[model samples]
Target chain A: MSEFIKPTPMPRKYFTPTVIFLSVIALVGIIFVFARLIFGIGTVTNLSNQYPWGIWIGIDVAAGVALAAGGFTTAALGHIMHKEEYHLITRPALLTAMLGYTFVAMSVAIDLGRYYYIWHPLIMWNGTSVLFEVGICVMIYLTVLYIEFLPIVTERFIGRVNLPGLLKKYNNSVDKFLRALDRGLDKTMFIFIIAGVVLSCLHQSSLGTLMVIAGPKMHPLWQTPILPLLFLLSAISVGLPMVIFESVLTSRSFDLKPETPILAGLGRMIAPILFIYLSFKIGDMVIRQTFVYLTEFNTASVMFVIELVLGIIVPLRLFMSPQIQRSPLGLSIASFLVIFGVFLNRLNNFIVAYTPPYQFTPYFPSVGEIFVTAGFIAIEVLLFRAFVMIFPIVSVPQIPAVHKTKFSIRGAK
Target chain B: MANQSRRNFLKTSALIGAGLTGVSSKPAKAAPNNILDENRMGVLVDTTVCIGCRKCEWACKTAHNLSAQSIESYNDRSVFKNMRRPDDKTLTVVNEYAAKGDDQFPVDVKVQCMHCDKPACVSACIVGAFSKEKNGSVIWNGDRCIGCRYCMVACPFQVPAFEYGKAIQPEVRKCDFCFDRTKDGKLPACVEICPMEVLTYGRREELIDLAHQKISLYPDRYVNNVYGEHEVGGTSWLYLAGRDFHELQFPKLGTNPAPGVSEAIQHGIFAYFVPPIALYALFGGVMWLNKNRKQDEHKEANHE
Candidate 1:
């Protein structure tokens, strides 16, 4: 059996050509973001009254939230299910979720016409609104994610709070503070872990409910009463795949051996979840008699077919094969397909499936809108790289005790 | 040791569950000002009597303090060559549809917010920035709005319009039923300005009776159906049209209120917050059970 590896900060050089490219893209995106803030959403986005939402909502907010599901799913698997072997991937998943939610919140702020008044939902309650439920849940879940991440911070800094120069005198006091925080968090963590999972389930489904109010305006192929249930299931199904995708990519980027055993185990579990999601999606369509729409060759039907066959069915089949799950390249392909499917599903639900009455022109994202979304993605990638470099996130082969001691001494210095 | 920990976990979870239930059990707060007052007013739009004059458009803009061209400019009928919708700049628009069979004159339809009894905007607003006033006007509160534009998504008639160009303090624009004028005991601007008497302002209940009475009295002149009477669980604005409503660009909608399905799902998911709390407790139980099982297996291995 392969021995377990301890998570350690990657020792690779930080600024590669790819990192520099991503930074440039992120900078361009920031320029557009500022332009949007100054000139209003109308100038930067193709959003009009007929299509008030664009890629900012479909890609940045919806897909961002869906992709972040890896965090809670892993927490549930490793901690809640007591699957000790799976713990190796949990920290990276947590970090991804923390960053994912932070961006989602930021995207929402930028997308809102009155970004400054984003806090109104907290004080002014609307129990009837689906968006209100989603907003409040996301706010609470983001806080929960930050709280769950506290232990990792404490673990890194508890005994290593070496402040520089004038602040060096306070290092001992800071270390003591971190130690106390670590102890307090250790006892209360299980509650938060469970809460995190519960909150994720609530908001993920409620996100589907966001579009439900666009009755008759939405294309029949996507709209159904069980939309919330479908949203929750898809989110659950995508969770492990997202973890696998990020894990494989991280392993490649950092030149570390992939955790094939754990990833294969996760891949095996994904088949059943994807099957459940597929069955419900097809079942809902059939029950609603929406399949008749497939006979008509339109944008909605073609997009629906692509979303189902490519995103869900293909990935489902790929993951079921043990050979595919075990191979690094195969696992990456399968996981990417699943991620692509969820991403496409979000875009389809928010953009393609919506058909407003009196729409003179269909909404297409402006150049600025595309750049802003790309920038957010680039920033996310840059943050992920920076985090893994500084923190003990990715697990690598365990070093011998003597070598480990030497490494620690060098790290401290 | 495992059993002791399990018992302690269960006890703590039960306490948490009880506290959560207490939080959810407080009296349900209904959305403010949704009582549907018995004496609420309405407008009865008699489309058959309306000539293709765009006077209501000019008056609406003037009433809302929007920039309006000379009333003489309204006489230009070429604007109706293309179908138009109520938009940010114009709260109401008049469209002329060709007469169906033998009628000598074309039918003119004035479009604006239908102001449903159970308004979707009132239910869908994230901050409850919209309310159904006692006077039967479904109005938006700009002071409370965060400009999410969800109201635009929820309005069944697609009535609410947003000021997309203005970066600072952009507002949602829609027909407010002339709430400001109504409050001062004045008729709505369009109602006051209609030279044709095509629009009648009165109590909603009385208007519904008057609409049904008009259709019954002039069976040949008007369609048997009264638009908005039962559509979307009934709107405050009733209409009597010569042709089918669909011909006049009115969307065919079910009688169930626009917000019915979404609100039902929202309430069901969050009903008493019981489902989420139950899910939390169930997860706790499973975690405890799994931990105990692992602990037992480890002890057995140690014994070997």
Candidate 2:
């Protein structure tokens, strides 16, 4: 049997050519974001009154929320279902979710016209609005996510509270505080875990309901009464794939052995979830007789076809293969296709299908818009790297005492 | 008119039944003042009579405190070459459609907020920023608006336009049906300023009668249909067009209210918060059972 590995902070150089490139992109995006705030949204974006939503909403908010489903899905598997073996991946997924939601809130603030009054939804209630439901659930869910992540913070700092010179005297007290926090969080975390799952289900579906009111203005191919159900199903389906995708990428990046067994198990489960989602999606279309639009050869039809066949069908086929599940590259490719499919689905639903009448010009993201979106993504990656470096996120194999000196030398180098 | 009254009665009964069943007990909070008061005001536009003078357009701009050019510039008929929607700069616009098959004069359609009885903006605004007043005016409250622009996406007529140019406190601009003026017992700016007496302002019920009367009297002059009568569960603004409404850039819509399906789904998911609470309990129960089963297995393994 192989030796057990403990979760540990990755020991690696922080700055690389890729990091520098990402920082430059992130910096340009920050400049554009500032321009969007100081100048009007109109200044930095191609968004007109006709198209109030742009890529910030489609990619940053919708896709961001969908991709972050890894946290809850893994939590449900490891904690609720008592699948303790999957615990190795849960922390990274949690961090991803926490960061993803924080960015979602930031993106929302940037997108709002009167961004200062974003808190209005809290004090003033509109139970009837799907947006109200989405807003409230997201606000509550973000809090739950932060609460869920608190234990990780305490875990990292509990016995290692080494304050600097002047504050060194308070290190003992800080350590005591972290210990108490860790104990308290350990008992209360189940409540939060369950809440997170419920909240995710609510808002994920409500996001679909957001477009339902657009009615005839939306393309017939996407407009249906069962949109909320389809959204919830798709989100659930994407969750495991996202976890597998991130896990494989992280292992590859850090030159660690990919957790192929755990990931292969995850891959086995994905086919069924994806199949369920595909069945409902195609079922809805058939029942509504919307498949007729596929023959028309339009942007909406072409996008819908690609999003289904490439994003769902191709990955579903690949994941069903035992050889592919065991192969890291094959699993990564299949997982990526699912992630890309979901991302494209969100973009298509929010931007492509929405064709307002009397539209003088079609909306395409401007240079500034593209930069800001790319910048947000780069910042997420940078933060993820920084997080894993400081926190015990990834698990590494235990080393023997005889080899420890050599390992230490390599880590220092 | 008989059919209209019967539908109204059924609607009222349905609402009362829904309220009695505790499904939508708080109707005021459930929708934005969905009372449907009998005396609610409406405007009837006779497109056959309108000359496309653009007087109402200038008057609307002036009344809304938007800058308007001199009244003489209003005679520029060339502006009608392209269809224009009401935007932040103009709360109302007059668009000209070509006359159908040798008809002498083209039709002039005034584009503005239809102010539906079941207003989608009131139902879609995240912060309850919009309300349907007793005067049948669907108005937006800037103080409550975060300007998320969900209302813009929800409007069946595509009326709400955001002021994207404003960096701060950008307001959603739409026709409030001149709510402020009409509340003080004055006519809407467009209704008062029309030279051809094209726009008629009155109680919604009375206007429907008048619209029907005009349609029956001048069968050859006007289409039999009154746009917005039952479209999207009835709008406060009624239109009498020379031809089919779709030809004049009006979107064809079903009789069901725009927010009906969405609201139903929302309520179903969150009815008394039962489903969510039940889901929470179910998860908690499964977790408890799983934990117990795992402990039992561990104890058995220890014995072994």
Candidate 3:
């Protein structure tokens, strides 16, 4: 038993590289951000009123919400469906969501024209706008996520071992209180879980609606009234797979036990959702007769076909094979492909496919834009590492030992 | 393009169908086509008499205190390749037209806000940034503009442009039909500035008659149809052209108004406050049921 079940404390050393890399990237991004602010948007980004939104819209809002889709998916199966087998994977999905949203909030700060006046949208009233609804929903959802992560933060910052003199006394009560609070949180999660799912459904779709008003300026291949539905479905399709990919990577890096079977099961469930997405996506195209454009190889036409093939069909086919799902490297690659596909599809919608029919220049995200995007990702990671270290996020049994298991020793989560 | 258009038309109907499906059980009947109220005001532009000189564009810029275009002094020789549309800096532009079968081939169109009676920009705006005044002007207020640039996107003419350069003081700028001029009972800056007595501002009924009169007078030169007469549910500023209107970059669109289709759909779905209210109730009920189910499971486990 001793030979099979040796344990090691969380190492402080492995975190250095991640910290150093993020700091270097963030410093570079901060400089470019100032260039954008001081010299005006025209100086930095290729964005025109013709394409007022560029990479920020695509990467920050569209992809951000889609990445954040894991939380709702996890909540759906784990909490509402009452599946205890998947409980260990919930914290990882929640971590992904928290980071995804924090990045989004940062993106919003950088993207807004009158950055200060963003509060006006919140403070003022406009009942009819889908944007207003989305804004309110996302804000409420963000607040709920922090509350969701509250136990983790408390555990990290207020541990009995970490707490110094007087506060450390009656550590048993503190431990008891934390456990009870954690259980209470689990008990009361139905409302937030449901709200998160629905709000995600609304806002992800509403992001499509944001561009719907661009009458003739947008290319016909991208613009459709069913945009909201397409966006919502695509977000879910991308999100479920993302959770599996992220969970495995984090587990491996942290030297934790594998959550492969549960994650693979989740990946299998996403297959049908992807099918629905593919059906609607293709059905919309075929019905619109955009398939004819596949024969004609213009920039717009090629982009339209490429977006469909890479973002949809390829990822769908890759994930279907049970053989590939078992291979960690294969699963990771497939996950990366799906994520990239979703991100590219959004960039296509927000930038590539968007056009001012009256003939204006195109828009692309600048170097500064890229940095801001990276910084958000970094902040989320930093927060995640902090959360996992302090909280009971990884189930204790899942941590992998450096020595091979004599009797099936579990690995890191 | 023809086959694609037919497919698009089919998709448009499908969209209308999909929109209706999400709403109430009752099937949607077509609203009355005879619902147009023709008492609205308009402007009349005579393309034949108009010289290529851009007096109206200059006057509009000066009146609005907008940035003067360098293309004005340089002309189309160097900058037609770098052609610009109405933007935050330039509120209006006069594209030089040298029509065939003429010595100089000199004709110009002074383009600005069309001041649509049923404006798409107004409907597209979530906040009341753009509004249709009763006195026949589509006015804009900077205070309420979210800088979402929906107005820029919604304008079929590509008229509204954003102040993307100013991070703090950005606002959407366009010709507001020179609402300030109309309020003081004066002609719009463009109309007042026209050197050739080509552009006319008056009640829409009077303008339609004037357009017809010019088209009749120069049956050889002028096209019979008034450009803005039935475009996008009718605009206050009308146009009479020598060649086809679309040749001059005028977008060919439906007379039914763009906003009418989108708003009616949004309103029908959002009307009676059904969607959000129903969604909230359903969520609340599910949460309550879920809480009880978890408790029941807990009790069963304890008993075991």
DockQ of each: 0.52, 0.60, 0.19
| Tens-digit lDDT track of model 1 for A1-413 | 22335667876798999999999999999999999999998989999888888889899999999999999899899888978778878889999999999999999999899999999987666778888888989999999999988877787787788899999999999999988888888888888899999999999999999898888989999988888999898898888999999998898898777878788899999999999999999999888999999999988999999999999999999998989988989988999999999999999999998888778899889999999999999999999999898888887767433331111111111
Off by over 4 Å in 3: A1-11, A154-187, A396-413, B1-40, B67-82, B102-104, B260-273, B280-304
Give the alpha carbon lDDT tens digit for every residue of A85-192 in model 3: 565666778878877887777676566665566666554434334455556677778887877766554454344434568876768677777666766765665666
Please give the lDDT score at residue A223 for candidate 1: 89
After TM-score superposition, what is the CA distance of residue A305 in candidate 1 from its true location, in Å? 0.3
What's the residue-level lDDT of A223 in candidate 2? 89
Each model's fraction of native contacts: 0.70, 0.78, 0.24
> Per-residue lDDT tens digits of candidate 2, residues B1-304?
4874576466556656765686743333543455678799899999989999999989999999999999999999999888899998998999998875774688899989998999998888887789888888999988789989999989988899989888998899999999888868888999998999999998999999999999899898888999989999999999998788988889888999989999999888888778888889988888889888878986998899
Worst ten in a row by lDDT for model 2 chain A: A404-413
- Poorest lDDT segment (10 consecutive residues) of candidate 1 chain B: B24-33
| Model 1: residue A237 alpha-carbon error in angstroms | 0.7
Q: What are the lDDT figures for the candidates, one per model?
A: 0.87, 0.87, 0.68
Deviation (Å) of B282 in candidate 2: 0.7
Encode model 2's per-residue lDDT on A350-409: one tens digit a residue: 999999987999999999989998999899999999999998888776763232111211
- What does candidate 3's lDDT look like per residue over B50-161, in tens digits? 7756666677887787766653663344333344577777777776655566564656676777888777677665454576665667778777666666566677777777
Give the number of the best model, judged by DockQ. 2
